[model samples]
Target: MNTAWIYLILAGLCEIGWAFGLKYSEGFSKLWPSVITVVVMILSFVLLAQAMKTLPLGTAYASWTGIGAVGTAILGIVLLGEPRDAVRLICIGLIIAGVLGLKFLAKE
Candidate 1:
């Protein structure tokens, strides 16, 4: 697998952590978790910038946001009991397709 892909995956995981952290932060009163969450989000963005060094900026950014949005939405549904309606599912599918399409275009 490409290093860029690995970085992107790491970025995605960081997004999940950061998204959860924002909820758990409780106005940033919980020191440790809040700090960790901020740090992880910063690191994720840094990794994203690094990945962009090789990948096209538009492609990298779009994929990063797409994955993060989809991941965070799924997390909200599973962990926070957010609704998982058909429209939301369709939107997620479209996001995934957009990410894949960008990747494929980059390969050409």
Candidate 2:
């Protein structure tokens, strides 16, 4: 509900965007995708910094990366036709659990 949390969530989503953009950019060979990726990457860092002003450093960083990893992995499976095996899904679930645990345990 806090603004810091919102910023953190948005930063996570931007992290996902940049990750996809990096893939589409093909090592920056593609102009537009590379530009977008750079912009989104900056935005993600800015938002993460904003959240860090309120959140504990460890909690904010871990949660941000966890969100990006989980989101990117799921999207990769759906959009990019990546693997959908049980072990992978279970691993993703574990990451989600860890992120949620960090969130709940965080004092702020």
Candidate 3:
């Protein structure tokens, strides 16, 4: 329930949104989506910086990137009809486990 943790979670959510926006941008052909994606991505980084004010930079960055990758991949599979093979699922699970392990380990 730490404020830094909340900020990190918000940053992760923003990353997911930014990723979706980027996909919708279609090489920036869609002006509004592309602009929104850029804005959201910047906001996400800003939030990450805020979180890093208290959290260790390496830990915060690793968690952020790990969660972002997992979330975006899951979103792609669910929303975009991307493949969900066993190997892909296992990889995603490993990413989640690694992120969780990092979080727990950092607490002590």
Candidates by lDDT, descending order: 2, 3, 1
Clash numbers, per candidate? 0, 0, 0
Model 1: ten consecutive residues of lowest lDDT = 99-108
Q: Which has the better lDDT: candidate 1, or candidate 3?
A: 3
lDDT of 3 by residue, 28-51 (tens): 899999999999999999999998
Give all candidates' CA lDDT scores: 0.86, 0.96, 0.90
Q: List the residue pairs that clash in candidate 1.
A: none
Candidate 1: tens digits of C-alpha lDDT, residues 6-60: 7877887788789789889887889988999999999899888778878878788
Best by lDDT: 2
Q: After the best TM-score superposition of candidate 3, give how far the Cα of residue 81 lies from its true spot, in angstroms.
A: 1.0
**Distance (Å) between predicted and true CA of 25, model 1?**
0.4
Model 1 gets an lDDT of 0.86
Model 1, which residues run further than 4 Å from truth? none
> Which pairs of residues collide in model 3?
none
Model 3 vs. true fold: TM: 0.94
Question: Cα miss at 89, model 2 (Å)?
Answer: 0.5
TM-score of each prediction: 0.91, 0.97, 0.94
- Minimum summed lDDT over a 10-residue window in model 2 is located at 99-108
